[model samples]
Target: MSNAARQQSSRTGLLAGFVLAALFMLSLFVGVIDVPFHRALADAGALELLLISRLPRTLAALLAGSGLAIAGLIMQTLTRNSYVEPSTAGTAQSAELGVLLVTLLWPSANLFAKSIVATATALLGTSVFLMTAHRLPPTQPFLVPLFGIVYGGVIGAAVTFVAWQADLLQYLSVWTNGDFSGVLRGRYELLWIGAAMLVAAWMIADRLTIMALGRDASIGLGIDYARMLQLGLVIVSVISALSTVVVGMIPFVGLVVPNIVSRLMGDNLRGTLPVVAMSGAILVLGCDILGRLIRYPYEIPVGTVMGCVGGIIFLWLLFRRPAHA
Candidate 1:
């Protein structure tokens, strides 16, 4: 809070931004086609690939990471739980269900309408998880995420059942794992909705901090805790649903990124918002680049890459804590 501290914070902020920007630029050039500056300058085809494919893929990764990271922060703050996130807490499953349901019923709805359904289902799903978490007695440290995973699996099974009956399993498979290969210029514009949610998250971070204090204190301080919680859930729904709808599922981003940020930067959401967003973007973008390079032209999905990496990290995080059961 002092001037020197503020200056130090600013410097750290700048350094993080510089790192993220550098990584982001590296991401734009690492895909199937290597767009060297000179080659792109000389060849219209290379230039077109840069503008259409490379640029959109890069933007999609960044937005998905940033949005999911902030959404993780919001979920953790609202629930007062470190383990809960869109993927584990049933939000992703709910959103996927919504997408599938819409696809089945309307069969011809536009992308935006399907996005609406996805967001709605995600909201319902996350609300159920929060309610369950509220009712259940807190026990072991590992139990919460375990419960979340099981809860999500049940919902996911329902989704799979519907997909199976209709013989749309392959279609459903796309949303379960995320990849940027299909993200062309026109197709990936929906990811901007997630970016917008991130901006809104920054604006409301203080209120979220206050609400996290506990329902009674937040109300005593004249903060509408319920409304804040609602807003937070809606933001989470939009980010998770939109990202899943646009880029499939990128797991553990909300869970892993926010915890890492909190460890490094403390629990002040307002102070750490940019760093959280940057870290999220960096993690996903970095993984996406790794996914592409691992097998060359046969690219693995970013969600699958994150799942493998994040699962290991999650196990380490679980056991690393002395109190975990």
Candidate 2:
């Protein structure tokens, strides 16, 4: 990159960092109960609330958003399609299925066990999508994500049917609806694993960028294509599962954030990955804060908020000029 471009990227990163930090502080204070920043340190109950609820919830949003966004970037890179993401590409639905099965069979299963099963199912589902997506004409990139949506819908239907039969629709709802209301300090630590996965992704960003060049090109360049594919699958699946297992399915963070970042920053994964992560954090965290204040004490789920926001953005992406994209 030229010095000017590097300077521009640095400034962008600094600006995004500032926005994210400001949003995090805003999130800490935006709830039904006013936990004044000044008194929070002095008041034991206020400090406890911040520690137990507000801080964890904010961090969970940050982790879930950034992780899923990175997962989306990886999926897009591996598939060479900008439209596919964990939620739209059957990965999140598969994770939800895994969580549902474990809940039914192993009622006493721990969060780790549930996440393990969910990750496995997500891996399988995403692999299936990749195979089928490859079969569709590469000339039509839109079909890949469309097929994934339908594919995910079928899996989601199966999950719903099973949940209905087992009289666990409520559990299904909890897993489907992404909210941080129930996130406490202990409940949300699973997401830190997703943070670790983010680090792993950054380390391999260049390999992933090469892998995006298609199998033949990557092979010619001495890349282990299959191994890299598997690694990417694991990263995507694990992040999807962790997010679902903890805060439910957050849509569009994965889909929209990556696309927006790509349009603005271009597809140098090494340069854009941090911005993607930070942008995702800001989007989801801001949405969560909005949900908290929109109805006051009666909060909307972040999933609902994202569905509205993400749907509009997805439409805009579809209709906008290819030149802009």
Candidate 3:
């Protein structure tokens, strides 16, 4: 990396950090109750609201964003496809199905238990996708996520069937819509697990980058491609599942953030992960803030906003494929 490139990366990182910070402040104060910054400082209720509600929600958004972004990066790298994401790959839907199962079966499962179930299901779903894909003749890399979308649709249909049978369709709707209004102190803390996963991903970023090169090449280089890939999938599953539990089914943070950052920073996982993480945090926070502002006194869910915007962005990326190829 040249000094100019380093300086440019530093500037981008700093700018992203500042944007994240500003958005966090906005998230804390921009709710329906109109808690002024000055009053929030002195008043206990306001302080409690800030600490319990706004702080946790903001933190959850940050973690969810960064975690999903890193997961997307890992997935894209592992599959060698920019379009693959947890949502696209049926992992998020599988996690939701897990949550629904736990809720229906136990009816009293704690948030931690629910998250565990979701994470396990997500991991299972990802493994199934990988195993199934391994059997098919190699095709376009994009086919992986396209297959995942079909797989997710199948799982989602099962969820709908079960929900209908159990008369819990309304409950399922809540899970699918991706609302952050449910985020509270104890409940939202589960998302911090995603923050921890991001740290773990950073530690193994170099190995992941190597593994992305192809199994034979990675093995020849003395790297255990299978283990590294499994570890990355586990991390991605856990992050995706936990985020789904906290914020419902957010779709494109993983897809969009990592793709954009990789384009800017190059595909080196070690250098790109932080930039992806920061970009994800900024995107989620900004979207959440927009959701809060656009429908004053009755906010739209951040997930809905992301889904709508992300769909458009996805289409744009799809149509604007590389010309030189």
Candidate 4:
């Protein structure tokens, strides 16, 4: 990394850390049942609320954000496309389909079973996307995820058809509309899978960086390109699945956070990974806090706010492409 890049990364890291801390504190104190920040430390009940409720929710946000950012980084690097992400590429949607299947086939499925099915389905969907993209000529790499969107829509329609036929539309709706309010003690434990994914991502960061140079180049360098791609797809699938299972479908965090970090800090995964993770954490937590504040006692889902802001940002990026190009 250049000295300037190092400095920028450090600055971003500090800012992200500060934002995460503030989010933690805010989540603990600010809720429908307001616990005064000053008094919460001393009051047992307030401390219990902080420890049991807000702390877990905050942790879930951090883990999910970081995990999804890492997933996006890997996908972009593997595909050599800035626009690609788990959400855009049908991984999350496939996961949702998996959840829907489990719920319909066996309504009493455990969280771990649901997550496993989701992960497997996500891996399959991502593999199909990669295979399809590989066969296409390299005219516009950005269009790959657009293909994924169509693919996702098709699979999503199938899911919807089955769901409607089974009269489980309400159950399916939960997976479509992301919500963090349901995160608490027993329920929020599912986010630990995201923590595991974060560790796995860091461990394989070097291999991913090498593979990002393209298949021919990576093979020339004696790296197993196919295996590397499979590993990366697995990571992306598992992380996206877990996040969707926990918080529902959060579309643009994977795309937007990693792209922002790559532009600011450059595209090396090792260097930008931490910044991407932190930025994602800050973004989600900030959005969640904003959602709470905007509606006051009646909180808005974090997913709703992200979708609104992300849509505007996506449009802005679309219009600004010519200038950047």
Best by lDDT: 2
lDDT of 2 by residue, 74-192 (tens): 99998899888999889999999999999989999999999999999999999999889879998998899899999999999999999999999987978898998899999999999
Candidate numbers, best lDDT first, in rank order: 2, 1, 3, 4
Candidates 1 and 4 compared by TM-score, better number = 4
lDDT of 3 by residue, 31-142 (tens): 8777998898899999999888888888888888888889889888878777889988888889989999999999998889999999999999999987776565567666
The alpha-carbon deviation from the true structure for residue 72 of candidate 1, after best TM-score superposition, in angstroms, is: 1.1
- Predicted model with the maximum TM-score: 2
Q: Give a tens-digit lDDT track for model 1, residues 121-227.
A: 99999988877775666556467667789999999999999999999999987898998888999988988988888888999977888877878888999998778
| lDDT computed for candidate 2 | 0.91
Q: What's the lDDT for residue 100 in model 3?
A: 94
Give lDDT tens digits, candidate 4, residues 52-113.
88888888888888888889888888888888888878888899999888888888998889
Candidate 1 runs further than 4 Å off? 1-8, 138-143, 319-325
| C-alpha TM-score for every candidate | 0.94, 0.97, 0.95, 0.95
lDDT of 4: 0.83
TM-score, predicted candidate 1 vs. hidden true structure: 0.94
